[model samples]
Target: MRQVESEEFERLLTDFEREAVHLETRDAYGTAVELPHMAKWAAGEPDDLSWLQGWCETLREHGRAGRSVRRARIVSEPLSDYQRWSHSIAHPMVDAGEDIRWVPRRLVSGVGIPGNDFYLFDDRTAVFLHYAGSGLSVGMTATEDPRAIGLCRTAFEAVWGLATPHRDYRPV
Candidate 1:
């Protein structure tokens, strides 16, 4: 049986703890977030995913502020009207300096829904998971690990460069 080294296991646990904090503290606005693999796993479909609710609330909170939380993504499936309605209500709050960021999604990436899973965060972090179904995870954290953050930042920059910004965006 393959066994993890004691030190390595400890480090992994520590990293998980750090990651939890890192993910929670940051203003999490993403294009294709792994909702299924959220920090919490409830029975069946997560009807009341606190993280998702928090995500929405965080965006809305940022929307109230002047700084908009932007997002870029290549859409795969169409969103429901209710989803559109919720976003539409939250998006404007950012523009109005209410406490939300106008997160935008770019449908330019040439990948299908199941094959394409990527997350980018404000040019600071990027994570690409499930490249070959083995599922990979990479991202930066505001922890003491400078090198880790640097690696994630590099990946984010690469994807950001290839992505297109929101259509309504007008550079300030």
Candidate 2:
């Protein structure tokens, strides 16, 4: 797996021709970018989702370009604070033309989920996210290994099939 910078990862999203799929396996992601938003969410402050405007625009642009974006999040029952926040804030993505789904971890009994979260582009390239134990993102690795790409595609599809749409999934 070749390590890639975050900018390169973003470029893959922009460059993909068909679709981009994301598999999120973690219950919490303690990234610097999310910390403040999470804090506000935890405090019950009304979220001003203007921060998502840029990402929403990106998704919109992709949609306009005939590309699809999808995400499947594997979450545990009795959702973590971060997960709840994530679920609550997903409407912007939906409005921007991205499809998001949530699969309860218990439902994935025999599914072979990868150790790290990943983004698969056009079913060809896979970018795996490495995170510290504290849930902080450390780095990313991108590869076109058929084995890796196939694994991610299979796992993501499995979860996507079983997951509930964001509108129907209520966080605990």
Candidate 3:
């Protein structure tokens, strides 16, 4: 498991030839970049998501190149503040050609999902993002191990099949 820098992780998205799939297992992520938007959403104010334009554009570019970007988020039943905020802001990504889905944690009881969040690229490279106790991203581990990639691909597909699409999911 070689630790990868954040830039390296971002590079994978642009470098992948076929698809990029992500599995988010955390209910909340304490990233400073998102705090302001999350606060605005929590306060019932209109969120200014201009900061995400770059990312949205990246997804759009991938779509133009005939690549796919998809994500499956496993969230608790009673949504956390972060989860609610995330749901509220998911439209931009969807509009940019990324497919996002939400899966209730309770429904994943018997699923053999990995504990950590990860991004699998082209079914070959798996980059597992590590988080601290407070949900801050610590680092990422990149692996090309077939066994690890197989598990991630299988688990993500299972969740994707069971999860609801962003347009249809109503957060609790």
Candidate 4:
């Protein structure tokens, strides 16, 4: 296992081959890029979501390459403010080819999940996300350990099986 800086982590997002599966176990986050967007959402301001175009374009390129990108979010019922805003902005990404799903936390009581959120690339590398209490990211750690890979695979598949496709889910 090795500690990965944010820049390397960003590279991993586009460098993977076959697929990228992400599991989000948090209901809230305070990422610098996202905070302002969420604040605008909270204030009922309009957001054209131009900032997301780059990622969406990336997704499109991945799609063209036959690479799959999927994300599963484990959220609480009634949803947090962040998730509410997230749902609103997901359409463009979904439209661009990422398969985004949501699983209500109550449904996963019996499943064993990793303590941190992560992105598993091509089922080989696992980059775990670490965060402060305020939900800002502290750092990221990456590993190619089989045990970590297996656990993440198991947990993500379990949640994915129970999750609702974004278009079909209505928060709470």
* TM-score against truth, every candidate: 0.30, 0.97, 0.97, 0.98
lDDT of 1 by residue, 21-124 (tens): 11111122332444343322323343343434545654444444433433333222343332233333343323433222222234324322222233333433
lDDT of 1 at 124: 32
Segments of candidate 3 deviating more than 4 angstroms: none
Query: Highest TM-score among the candidates is held by which one?
Result: 4
Clashing pairs in 4: none
RMSD after Cα superposition, model 2:
0.9
Residue range 1-172, candidate 4, lDDT tens digits: 7999878988999989999999999989999999999999999999999999999999999999999999999999899999999999999999999999999999999999999999999889999999999999999999999999999999999999999999999976
For model 2, how does the per-residue alpha-carbon lDDT over 57-161 read when each residue is reduced to its tens digit?
A: 999999999899999999999999889989888999999989999999999998998889999998889999999989998999989999998899999999999
Worst 10 residues of 1 by lDDT: 17-26
Per-candidate Cα RMSD to the true structure, in Å, reads 11.2, 0.9, 0.9, 0.7
* Clash count list over all predictions: 16, 0, 0, 0
Error of 4 at 49 (Å): 0.2
**Any idea how many clashes model 2 has?**
0
